[model samples]
Target: MNLMTLYDDVINEDCSMIVPETLNTPHLVLRYFRPEDAERVAELAGDIHIASGVLNIPHPYTIDDARDWIGQHRFLRDHGEEIIYAITVRESAILAGAISLRVNTEHAHAEMGYWIGRPYQGYGYATEAAGSMLELGFRGLSLHRIYARHLSWNTTSSGVLTRIGMVHEGVMRGHASKWGVFHDVHWYSIMDDEYYSSSVHADHPGRDPSGV
Candidate 1:
């Protein structure tokens, strides 16, 4: 479907906002979080290594935290503020991580963010999921720009952003403080025109060009 079709699907008779139910990638499925997934989410996200690499995750993440986070998804989506997907393996339906886009509807832009569990790292899952999100943001949501930020020391995340066709947008020195230490932040982004022109879209055969 084109943007208009996707846009209409995201709204119902009452005019409340909603996200596409699912987005598929070659080895993964992006879907909304379920209450049952909370335990696993806490298990994977509680790793100190996982929390240290990103700005927001608490090192001691718990199931309650996961539930709390998941609980906000619907309210946020209904307000046109965010979309968060549980990234799961297609074959086994196992939760690998989470990805999100915080949107600014009036500006037609969004910020992308994601993380893969330690056990699932280095398998290209994050990259695949991120590319699909870019498609949903630009093609499905008709967003003008999608940007992401990462800790400067996290070269792995920077590489994923680059592989997905995002341009390096510079860094904010001492911009983030996590666990009491200040860290610099690297920004990256891809515009609508840039995304359509990039090889990233053509490389993902599983992604439906018609939008999620």
Candidate 2:
């Protein structure tokens, strides 16, 4: 059997836990959000550099806004709609970013999304965390496909998507409005078989170190 079928067997046997407790890469840990994380979330996500690139964040992202956002994660997870993680360093345990997968169970796919704090942007944390998230979606949740999108001008995000083995699909012109400006969105995706066949996945040294 190929890697994809092998993963299906492994997940069916020992991976009985529904939602993973934590997901780990060589350098990062993707854990469930905590109430105490609001301060750091606000501090990192509130930056103009981060907020401006994504369509959802608003200017002056307040602590209340972070709390409210974090608050919804559990509800969403409990309902099997999404899984949101706080991305942190494995050694330092410092918050580096956030990553999430919005599941569409009926369609057997999930939409991946992520952002790194300005301080952590250059360290490859986004790519590392996102790769682990993809593993979680495919192997852990048995998702058939995982996809992500970025603003056309956000080449950094595009690079992260590519680094994680997603295939660039196409662009949606004027697909979203961010900070009162409309922007084209470039989409990317990877199917389970495609991921298993990828060089990145074939030699993925990180391998969700926590095995979640």
Candidate 3:
């Protein structure tokens, strides 16, 4: 079977709880968010530090809002073409953040985005989670290019992209607006060739390491 078919088999579980969690390295994990996650999600959603970088998440996010958000994720999880994964720590059931992938069939590529809670910042959760998502994009999804971007002023997100080894593709001036405030975004991408070459080198030491 193709990788997409296997990936489908993996997430098609009826209970969702039955889906085996993907262990991304050791510090962070990527998994489907459960409805029970609403309360915990509210804590992050309410923080301006966490929500500001995002275009839609408003400060003082309501519990009722979180309930609706969870319901939305559940619907997307079951029927949508895109995949969204929540980043959570293993020891604690608390959610640190979330990352998502949107495929562009026309371009034969996908784009990724993410956010982390304020308290969880600087611990490298975004970096770790992004690496896992990159692996999924290049390997599981078998896509040609995976891109990610963030507002130019959002240093935390820029750092996360750099940490994950994505090559910056420059900025989009006045790309979007939030709360009537215009924001520019920096774009970054990794191609299938880039990912494959890096993986081959990392897997084989004492080699040229440059895909020479």
Off by over 4 Å in 2: 1-17, 202-212
17-77: candidate 2 lDDT, tens digit per residue: 2467688777887898899999999999999998988778888999999999999987787
What lDDT is reached at residue 157 by model 2?
Answer: 90
True lDDT of residue 73, candidate 3: 66
Model 1: per-residue lDDT, tens digit, 1-212? 22352555663444345667889888889999999999999999998888998778897999999999999998888877889999998877889899999988767789999999987887788889999999898877888899999998899999889989999999999999998989999999999999988876644433322211
Q: Backbone clash tally for model 1?
A: 0
lDDT string, candidate 3, 1-212, tens digits: 12342255533324121123454546666787778778888988788876778876887898878788767765554543467788876556568888887765446477887888776766767777778777776666566898988888888777777666678999889998877888898899888888777742221111111211
* Ten contiguous residues minimizing lDDT sum, candidate 1: 203-212
Worst 10 residues of 3 by lDDT: 203-212
Highest TM-score: give the candidate number: 1
Candidate 2 has its poorest 10 consecutive residues by lDDT at 1-10
> Candidate 1 local accuracy as lDDT?
0.84
Whole-model Cα lDDT per candidate?
A: 0.84, 0.80, 0.69
In candidate 2 the C-alpha lDDT for residue 151 amounts to 92
* Candidate 1 pairs with clashing backbones: none
